[model samples]
Target chain A: MIAKVARYILFSLWTVALATFAQAADFSGKAAVDTRFFTEPPIFAQQKDGVAYPSVMIQPEFRHDWGSGNNRLTVIPFARYDSLDKHRTHWDVREFSWLHMQKNWDLLVGVGKVFWGTTESRQLVDIINQSDLIEKFSGEEKLGQPMMNLNLPTDYGHFSLFYLPYFRERTFPSSNGRFLFDPPVRNSEGKLDGFSHWQPSFAGRWSKTFGDWDVGVAHFWGVGREPRLVPSFGQGFTHPPTGLVPIYDLIHQTSIDVQGVLGNWIWKAEAITRSGQGDRFAAAVVGFEYTKYGVFGGSKDVGFLLEYLYDGRSSFAPPTPFNNDIFSGIRVVFNDPQNTEFLFTNTVDLNTHATILGFNASRRLGEKWKIELESRFFANISATKNPFAPPKEILTGMRNDDYIQLRVVRHF
Target chain B: MKLKSLICGVLLMAAFPALAQTDEEKGYAIQAEANRRDNGYIDSMHDAVMTLKNAQGEVSTREFVVKTLEVADDGDKEMGIFHSPADVKGTAVLTFSHGTKPDDQWIYLPSLKRVKRVATVNKSGPFVGSEFAFEDISSWELDKYRYRYLRDEEIDGNDCFVVENYPVYEYSGYTKQIEWLDKKMYQPRKIEFYDRKGALLKTLTFSDYNQYLDRYWRAGKLQMDNVQNGKSTELLRKNYRFKNNFSDRDFTENALKNVR
Candidate 1:
């Protein structure tokens, strides 16, 4: 009850502060209503019924600038309420930072977000923030990380230094959610309390462009965002393996990303080497996207994408489904006033023959509204019951969780 | 006697400049003069409201801010930040134009907080659902086309030089373009684009000319009409500010991400 009161007070204070800033700053936001449909019934009895899940989300962004546009403050707060799954309802501060721009350098402080990679199949080199798995499984959504960032551009390249002061634990579905893991992660409220901590980490990157090529090299000594699942037995839990507790470890990673364009083809590659989680391992993703403009003698463009993913690590390391996979996708853009687009992708595991298919289509409703359709299907998923066979694919738990979702967003 | 004859020949050449010039040479000279007259603004910025109308007469609009920095001995660097079509707000695109080779482009998607390299070979694709193609709006360089002088023409009571420009760049949507250059401003008053099949595809007209910094000529409104599709687009520009002190750093990917 005391914690609830503190949260209420903080919410009120934040609202009051934003109201005050509205008079002099720029304010914008988006509110989205989402509905998802599962193709099959729930695999676990503890999970919610398999059918339609409705949710509503809102994100408000406020930016204030002073001192001749050299000093700036941006705040973005997001919240979602799901009708079916309580754990899926959450809140996050996407970004709240102050940026001070100078002639040769820039400084950013407070909670911020940064992205660093070029591959379309996977972001092997992007490791700044924890993934918001509850929001999406594609790892595109991230929780803001508290950081002190300094960017310097010199004659050689663009250099950026980061001092991350705090770490955010990755969000995961609760036991009653559709995408729950085998042992059900301990992510429910009050179950995973006191899991995140304030640990200082350091990172740096240097990026530059030469002719048609863009290259970036970076090094990070920090807490790894991916956590190890530790079996834990707690009160009111089943025996054998009651729940899995996440354990974040410190790691040292060095990565390089390069992208170049030739004629109609855009090539991208990202490679990373890391240690501290287990034996030192290296991973890489290389791909290219070829675009054909004015296809069918019309104002439509189609692009074909192909990428290969490879990861080398011992069995003791954190499990990943993309150990040896090939990703292929197609993107279509209809050059109409509505700005309609469609994307279809498939990731196939070379060893296990497990494939995941994804499709997304989106179009604008007008100047202020937009609609999107998204679906994901898992095929050829094998069960882990047979220990004699090769270890079951990591995505076995989600074999029955194929879903199609629709979202309508209104921007203000 | 030899010096006298040489002096007479030089004077004759100056008096009748067309006599010594071929069609290509004359066209090149005219374009070079126009380029020279429009140099040294250093940088510029403006807000643009784009209205796209389909064949059925339905219309949609978008708003953005365009910033450009002049690069000596190369094509200009440009950055555009979208403000309207609210879903696309805070999205920015940075382009570095080059000569002979394809331009380098990158787009910053605010929702993803990621910057992705855009393929520049799609120069024929429409820009944001507008009638204007990517090649039409890119920074214009002299070497991108081969010039041929056509007969003089009068447009809206203004004396204009009609010149034919054959695109030297590959994958251009147009076979050739006929540009009517205003003799006084050295700026294009009108342009007619021919499709790859050697048929007229679109016509573009520029109006409301405004001079900035006592040197640069900027058009306040531009209209493009596609003859075959029966669609049109209008680009209305406002708040033409020049010499914004924008440097190379302001046109980089880092700068694009910071464009709120």
Candidate 2:
């Protein structure tokens, strides 16, 4: 069967390669090794701190086009192996999609990906697809989503209309997985409030770029990407795992993003207001980056970044540490033969005084491999004072989860 | 020379109120004439292989393709997609350069699978770990610098006109640049860049010129040597195609992210 499938794929590709003006489809992917060291021991029930072991991932992609660059088909598959945490060992079809292009218009169908946002810290305005939470904590990884998108071009901007037929639940770690709740977070099933499984969601955005300004405003009306968990008491048992249930809420969100560039200065702003997720509330992130090239007359660059983040519902908001905070970061780039860079960031909570600092340094190795060193540390984290800690938030008890990570990626 | 000067005199007289007539203005006129002679190609696309060597003679190479569309009033729109050197094979960069304004750039990372809008602040930094700066690989706009004609000289048995240009844009790492334009072809044969300290830092050489449409000239090879670091980079051109009918839509961030 494997041989037959391989032969079939080769035959199809061979036939398409004969088409007129036909450029061969792109075939590419990567192999990666990711691991983490938990510094301290596990403080929670199922937490095993030390080293989480090495997890290996192999991903492959195939993208093909036909008929005057209008029709296209893409397929990507990912698989990983993990020694520890069963949740970390997984597989996914990141995208298997089709695209059709027309004059000043385009159509996208099947399982694809769409991202919308301008902020570096968080993408609050991107709500079409569910997050692949088990992948990482940075929220940069996403799962494939099924949708039919209609895009129209205008003189001033672009308008995108979306139709998402089904909702996807966020992935989570199992009871044996590392960095999870005491009794595990996943229940037997998902329960969404005021929405059904077959409900079709709708979303749209209008984006354009002026001489110095790039701006976009988007609106989403459907199931919320985030959830509110209702923990069912586990009889207060000491060991045997039992209960936590996630409740999905239907919501309507409207957002806007603006970015302006001037020589060495870049300013950005993202604001959002959402309804149906408790009460109507708003949030905003405003920031700017300034950089100096050839610092000290050398071929090095240093960029300073400052951002202010605020959420209307301070205490009542979700268990995130960024309700009212100041974020500052520094980026150093070595424009050398090795292509090395370092980034350091600090986010400080105004009300709770909880501070988190993250640092990442990356460099190219040889020609194919890239190595990244990352460290995240939390300071002044008080369970009573921290909104992101304990019974209020899933990670409240995980205040001590701060650790260092090293990952190596090889692109083929 | 008499007829050409008479025509130039008549033209300058009709436009006397707009520009000051001086040596600086004469330098600008010379450069503008060369620029206008190279205009109206519509668009172009090409492939390049870049090789770099260090002071110790260690060598590495990268492969990429570029699509550039010339705009009438503004600077050009360019997109570059890497093809080889596995670590950054699928990385792509889109740039929109304006005359005297800062450029807008976006980078697409295949790993994180997204497009990142990069703040174009360190344009003088190296390109792809090579000796060429980011601005060196971009389209040349006439308004970016102030020009002054130095003199005429002979290089490689060919008569050349020398001109010195000082960058007026902010955040540039170079203090000034001197260019040698071949008299017959009006093509840049060599360029010398001075550091911020007014010291000669690097020199660029262009050779193996090929003319498309029998009018526009393009170099098949470009080499930059960093005198300070004793390192060098060479760009060898492979294919050059013109008039591809590219539009603004092809250079947008959306198009950049979706390029397979």
lDDT at A266, model 2: 81
Scored against the true structure, residue A179 in model 2 reaches a CA lDDT of 55
All candidates: DockQ? 0.79, 0.51
- Candidate 1 docking classification: medium
Candidate 1 at residue A380, lDDT? Answer: 93
Candidate 2 residues lying further than 4 Å off, grouped into runs, are: A1-23, A49-52, A181-184, A194-196, A236-242, A313-318, A384-390, B1-26
lDDT of 1 by residue, A174-241 (tens): 77887766656785422222344777789999999887888999999978887766656665434455
Clashes of each: 0, 2
- Model 2, position A403: C-alpha lDDT score: 72
Best by TM-score: 1
Q: Who wins the DockQ comparison?
A: 1
What would the per-residue lDDT of candidate 2 be over residues A46-137, giving only the tens digit for each residue?
65555657789998877788898889887888888876678768888888888998768889998878888766676777788888877876
